[model samples]
Target: MQDLIAHAPVLFPLLLALGASAGFLAGLLGIGGGIVLVPGLYFLFKTLGYAEASLMHLAVGTSLAIIIPTGISSARAHYRKGAVRMDIVKMVGPGILLGVAAGTVIADHLSGAALTIVFAGALLLFAAMMQIPPKVRDEGHAMTPVKGSAGGFVIGGLSSLMGIGGATLNVPFMTLNGVPIHQAVGSSSALGPVIALPGTIGFILIGLGVPGLPPFSLGYINLLAVCVIAPLSVVAAPYGAALAHSVSVKTLRRVFSAFIIIVAVKMIWEASHG
Candidate 1:
C-alpha cells in the first residue's frame, strides 16, 4: 500500500492514460481492449516494484474485471441495433463456461513467466491476423451444435488464459464459418461477458491467499486498477466508436499491428533476459 502511494505521482497518470487508450482503441478497432490492458498494466505494475511472481496474474485478473461493465454496455448497444445473435450466444455459452473453468485452473497452475509468454503469443497472433485484409466470400457452412460448442470452447479457454474478451478470435471464427461480419461482431460482443464473468471469478478464487499481491487486490484482481480504468475506458469508448465513422480503419489497423508486434517482442525479450 505504501509503495503504491509513494509511486502515485507517476502511476496514477499512467493508469489513466492506459484506460483512455484502451477505450479509444477498442471503439476504433472493434476490439475488447484486453490486448492493451494486460500488457499496459503488467508493465505499470512492474515499475511499481510489485512481486514478480504475481505481476502477470495481477494484470490478467484485473483486466478481466475491468471488462465486465464495458462489455455489458457494448452487448446491450449491439442488441438494441438488432446486431446480436442470441441464438449463437446460447449455442456457445455452455461450452464457453466449461472452457473458462478449465482455463482458470490451467492459469492457476502456470508461473507468471509462462503466462507472460502465452499472452505475448496471443498478441503476435492477433497482430498477424489484423494485418491480413478481409476477403470477400459467399455464405459459408452452417453453424451446428458441435461446431459452435467446439469453437466456443476454444474461444473461451484461450480468452480466459489471456484475460481477453475473445472478440479477436470469436469474430474471425464466426465469419469464417459463414456468419455475416456485423452479426459476428455483435455476437462476439455478447460473448464477452460469457468469457469474462467466470474468468474473473476464476482468477479471484485462484489468487486468494497468494503472497506479494498489490494493495487493494481481491485475489488476483487489483481493485485499484479496475476502479481507475473501468470508468475512463467506458467514457472513452463512445468517442472512439464515433471516430470510427470518420477514420481510416485500414491505416489504423496497420499501425496497431505494428504496435502489438513491438509489445510482443519486448515482452519475450524481457522474459528471456530477466
Candidate 2:
C-alpha cells in the first residue's frame, strides 16, 4: 500500500497509458480489454510490491471491473453503427450468467500460476484460430437455443477464468456461424459487459477475507486501478469502435491475431521463467 502511494507519480502515467490502449482495443476487438488488462495489471501490481500469490488474482479481478464501463461504451458505439446483434446477445445471456457462477468458484481455487497458464494457452489457441480462414466460408444456419446457449455457457466459463468478456470466443463463434466479422465484433462488445458485471461481483466476493491484498481493494477488484483505468477506457472505446468500422475485415483479423500472439508468447515466457 505504501509503495503504491510513493510511486504514484510514475505509476499513474503508466496506468493511464494502459487504460488508453485497453479502451481502444475493447472497442476494436470487443474483448472487454481483459486480454490486455490482465497481463498489464499483473505487471504493474508486481512492480508495486504485491505478493506473487495474489498478483494474477488481483489483476484478473481489476480487469473485470474495468471491463464493465468500457464494454458499455464500446457496445453503445458499435450499436449506433448498426453492427451489434441483439438477437445473439439475448440467446446467450442466460448461459453466460450460469457459466460465470461456476467459473468464479473455479478461479478462486486455482493458483495464480495455473490461471496464468490457462490465460496464455487460451490466447494462443484463439490467435491461431483467427489466422486460419474457415474452410467452407459458407453462411451458417440460424443460431438455435441448444447451440447458442450451450456455446455461450462454454465461452462464459472460459472467459471468467481469463477475466475477459466473452469476445475472444464470441467473435470467432459468430463469424464461423455466417455473421459478418464487423457484426460479430459489435455484438461481442455488447455481450462483454454481461460477462463482466456478474464476473466482477463474483471475484469481489471470492476475494474477501483473503490476506495480502492491496489497499482500496473490494475483494479482488482494486478500486484504485479501476478508478484510473475504467474512465479512460470508457472515453477511448468509441474511437476504437469507429476504427473497427473503417478497416477491412482481413486487416482486423490480422491485427488481432498478431497482437494476441505477441502478448501470449510474452506472458508464457514470463510465467515459465518465474
- Top candidate on lDDT is 1
Candidate 1, superposed: residue stretches over 4 Å from native: 134-140
lDDT of 1 by residue, 1-274 (tens): 7877798899889989999999999999877789999999999989888899899989999999999998998999999999998888888888899999988999999989888999999899999899775442455575677889998998889999899999988888887777788998899899999899899999999999998888899999999889999999999998998999998988999999999999999988887677
Q: Residue 262 deviation, candidate 1, in Å?
A: 0.7
Model 2: per-residue Cα lDDT over 245-273, one tens digit each = 87786677778788878888877787777
State the C-alpha lDDT per candidate. 0.89, 0.83
**Residue pairs with backbone atoms closer than 3 Å in model 2 (clashes):** none
Model 1 steric clash pairs: none
Cα-based lDDT at residue 103, candidate 2: 88
